[model samples]
Target: MIYVVEDDKSIRNLIEYALSEKSYQVKTFADGLDIVDVVRENAPELIILDIMLPGKDGIEILNEIREFSDIPIILLTARTDEFDKVMGLESGADDYITKPFSVLELLSRVKAILRRSAKKDTDHINYNNISLNTKKRTVKVDGKLIDLTYKEFEMLLFLMNNIGNVITREDFLLKIWGYDYEGETRTVDVHIASLRSKLLDAGKLIKTVRNLGYKFGEI
Candidate 1:
């Protein structure tokens, strides 16, 4: 299911019409208040949020939702400023689209995100004594559970998915932080450090490739 949260009636109706026509189950909202309750009842697969709303703006709602859910979110707003986009991504949005967007473009992005998420739904990765359940988003090493933040879990998942292969910091920034992310490579280093600390003995599986990048699964 998809949730569309926009204050404008016409825009909400148009988005609903377009998505419903494509056979997607959708629900529309005119404010942020009701969404909090609705999500508690049943969370949608993806959310389309408008930055400008009656109150509690989109960023606030996005941050609140990230507290318990990692559901994909696409920000739809008229704010074309680079700072707004960066802030939205930093706030946990999976993608961003400025106002006056094409419905076709929106639909395509929705499909792509859902498709990628679905591909990762059922698969589990295991190497030596470490186990990662993608669907449950759980990690365990030597029969001990590890608590990881969203980004930390994703960073570890990406590396384990391509065991024995080197991945550059630039690639990590693009894939994990979104293509538009303006953050430096240092962000990757920081997250990797945290992830390694949590992984305990399994952390040694990840190795620095000497000016190239990072590689997982032994040297």
Candidate 2:
């Protein structure tokens, strides 16, 4: 699902109509608060956030959402501040788009990211106590269900899909976080920890190499 939070009803309708033409499940909101609750309850795959929201700005929404979930966010803003864009990217936005943009260009970017992310999941993954249904965005451990945030699921799937290989922190920040963000490698480590903690006590399956990277080994 693509949740769009734009104040302008005309723009929102245009985007919704265009995306719907491609058969995508699209939801539109006039304000961040209008759909902020839905983000927690039923997280969409991607969010189109507007920076200059009425009550709560897009940056705040990104921060609030990042506190719990890591849904892929695409920031749409009128301000062309480099520092603000950097802040948005660092605050967990997967992509940033400036206002008065081309809908086709936006559509292409969204599709590309989602397609690449989807392709990354189905490549290779093997586990004894865990199972992931990539298409459904669901996970199972030891034949039981497990709950994971969007980022957690993506992080886990990325590791499992590349088991036995060492993935560097820089690579993770570039690919998963959507840029070579100016954050410490420890952020990746923290995400790995968060992903590992949810799996059924098999956190050690994700191996850490000192001064190197991470490797996922089947348990």
Candidate 3:
């Protein structure tokens, strides 16, 4: 099932109708007030969220959802500012669509995100006492479970998978956030910093490459 949270009744109905026409089960919400609790109870396959809401904004709701689940979220916004887009992407939104968007485009994005999420990697990666089980989507450092946000996990997995090689911020955006993403490269830095912090001492393995990017390996 899919969930759409939009304050505008017209837009909400439009989205609901469009998604339903595609044979997708959809639930609609007027605001983000009860989304977290509803998601906690029964997470949907994906969420279409409007950035400007009555109660909690989409970014706040995105952060709260990321705290527990990584359910794919596509943000909807009337604003065309870069700040809102960057903030949404940095806060864990899978994608975002500006207002006055085509329903066809929205459906396409929804389909693409759902398709990507369905694809899974079954490999297990271990490096420098950090254990990652891709199939299980779990990470352990020094034999203890470590909590990682969805982006953090993906960033770590990408780094570990390319040990001894330097990975640029642009590479990260293209690889983890998708090639079409237009957010600032600084988003990569923020996630890396948070990831390193959560990994504790093992964080040292992720070394900065001076003028280039980052490298994950023994220094």
- Which of the numbered candidates is closest to the native, going by highest TM-score? 3
Instruction: Estimate, for each residue in 106-163, the C-alpha lDDT of model 2 and write its tens digit.
Output: 8998898687656664632336456677777777654456889887888888888788
Worst 10 residues of 3 by lDDT: 120-129
lDDT of each: 0.85, 0.80, 0.88
lDDT of 1 by residue, 36-152 (tens): 657644668789999999978999999877755566899998987999999999999999999899999999999998887676645656565566888888997754689999999
Off by over 4 Å in 3: 121-219
- Clash counts per candidate, in order, are 0, 0, 0
The candidate with the higher TM-score, 2 or 3, is: 3
What is the overall TM-score of model 3 with all chains considered together? 0.58
User: Which 10-residue window of candidate 1 scores lowest in summed lDDT?
Assistant: 120-129
Order candidates by TM-score, high to low: 3, 1, 2
| TM-score of each model, in listed order | 0.58, 0.56, 0.58
Report the lDDT tens digits of candidate 3 across residue range 117-179: 776323456564677889888997645789998999999999999999999998999899888
